[model samples]
Target: MRLINLKPSRTNQLILALLPFLALLLAYALGSTARLAENPSDKLLPALSSIADAVNRLAFVPDPRTGEYLLWSDTLASLGRLCSALGISTLIALVFGMVVGMFPYARALLAPFFAAVSMVPPLALLPILFIVMGLGETSKITLIVIGVAPIMIRDLALKVMELPREQTVKAETLGGNSWQIALRVVLPQILPRLLTCLRLQLGPAWLFLIAAEAISADSGLGYRIFLVRRYLSMDVIFPYVIWITLLAVLTNVLIDLVRIRVFPWSELDKAS
Candidate 1:
């Protein structure tokens, strides 16, 4: 039973492609077991079946009435907010990270601040941002940016510092001045790792999204989650989870697709 020896192949890839769906199935199985443990007389299996059925129903094209079903507008709205926030944070992270990371003194001065702020919890910023920026889209975007950028800065800075010294030296020797070496040579080498960090930040982005939307709005998956919690409805909970899970999967796939496009070398290396 040497699972570690199992190398990935086309079959593995296809199976792994279904892995997220498989996980949902497994979650359902475990949920039923937990329900049975809690109550011997409870109809756990039937409840699980109903939840699965409701998931399919709600997934259909929701009608014009807002609360009639899980409207696609809400999903798009949530995703749009995420994109705005994540986009700004990514750019800020890349620029500030590369610039400050290249300089030892800057890293010393700023890295501690970045690390400290990250520990404060992005939810703590929600009230202030909501007041200052209001319950507007700006507040939501800022929430995600605050949550995501610190980790980005930390990872990006570390990766930049970890880059091979020979690249820097060679650039300098080739008449590439300070700015030229960092912008032209160093950045290209580090962009792949930066992309990886951005991908990793998506989970935190979701957390911040909840914080942002929990305050105001009738729509979005996070708000829907809250609505279900009010009634203690596990069936309703499943739909929101499915929505988020699908979105996360799609976002990661899109990012990876773009990553492969931008750096085809990574794919080549993987194949080799």
Candidate 2:
């Protein structure tokens, strides 16, 4: 009965995890009901059925203008841009991050430049991106890359620098040159860190993607959300926002699985 080690059972942990979300839903439902009771045409807080119907329409029904379900189309478009940008960012971070972190010359040359670039607010460059890259997919993807890559680089670089110097010295003693040491030693150690960096960057990457899509894009989750805002379609907007959150959560989970499966040592090292 001591308070020092009061760990909840798994069942209790599950309930605790779900409690806040359940409370939020109940609060929203009550508020929606109260609002609807006062004004039948309230769009600010649509009823549950309204949200369900909006989800059905967007997800199940094909758009009249285009022969595609709007929800699926928007999800696909957004996922495509997000995945492409993240893939590119991962490669860039792995290469440049390793180089910058491992080599004093590279760090001296690129670290300050990247540091300055990272300071420039990614959103502020949206106008310039749109102008230079045109109102196309390139701009949206580029926006995400610019938003997340520098920070990813910095993080991975720091991770590399944090590696025990003894490992590098030992590798050198084994006749490994700079290139061989980076590829054989630093690369393996930083792979897990790169994944960690990507997981951390997902939120900002989504933000940049959404902003670019909201400002100028034919179709995306953000574009759809902003599009419905003109008509005050809370039902559509709410479901879309939930969908985006779910996607982000699922992606992070997948990344976690990959880290655990592919780099099991990373977790064990941390635990030890």
Candidate 3:
């Protein structure tokens, strides 16, 4: 009966998770109905049917100019940029974070710089990125890297630093050199933490990608949303926004599955 031990059944848990989303839909429906009753031409909060139609059109119909479905094209473009940036960032974070965390000299040299870089506002660097990298996919991907890399690096370095000193000492005592210890002892422990950091970085990564796309890209969810804003097409915009949210959620879920499958020990540690 205690609150700490209370556990809801799976059915109840699913309902609890969905309750807020249902409430949100109901509220929006009521609001849209009220607005339409007053002014049948209201576009600010379009009816559910209007939004559904817009989604169907964008997702199903091919664009006349590009001969590709806008929704899928934008999703593909954005996902490519996102995955590339994140892959580069992860490699950079893993290398630099391990070096910084393991070596005192490196830690002293790079930790402060990373801390300062993470503090800089990523959006403010959009102009610099475009100017330096040009208005292309490189710039868009670089924006995401710059936005999320520093923080991810810092998180990973801290995770590595938190590894017990006794383990490193034992590895050394067992004839393991720094390289051997790092690869065999440290890397395995840190991999799960790295995935967790990447999952956490998804939000900021999406923000930077969207900002870059909005400002310059020819195709992306953000570009599409901004392109339609001049016409005040809330239906299209709302559905696009929802789709983006779903994409982010799906990415997080995938990372969780990877962690569960690849590092089940990490989950066991957490549960204990």
Question: Highest lDDT: which candidate?
Answer: 2
Global local distance difference test of model 2: 0.95
| Model 2, runs deviating above 4 Å | 1-4
Model 2: residue 250 alpha-carbon error in angstroms: 0.5
For all predictions, the C-alpha RMSD in Å is: 4.1, 0.9, 1.4
Tell me how far the alpha carbon of residue 17 in candidate 3 is from the true structure, in angstroms, after superposition: 1.6
- For residues 1-272, could you state the per-residue lDDT of candidate 2 as single tens digits? 89988999999999999999999999999999999999999999999999999999999999998989999999999999999999999999999999899999999999999999989899999999989989999999999999999999999989999999999999999999999999899999999989888999999999999999999888999999999899999999999999999999999999989998999999999999
TM-score of each: 0.80, 0.98, 0.96
Residue pairs in steric clash, candidate 1? Answer: none
**Model 1: per-residue Cα lDDT over 131-221, one tens digit each:** 9998878888898998899889888888888778887888888999878888888788678777788889889999889766777766777
Locate the minimum summed-lDDT window of 10 residues in model 2.
209-218
lDDT, each prediction = 0.80, 0.95, 0.94
Clashes of each: 0, 0, 0
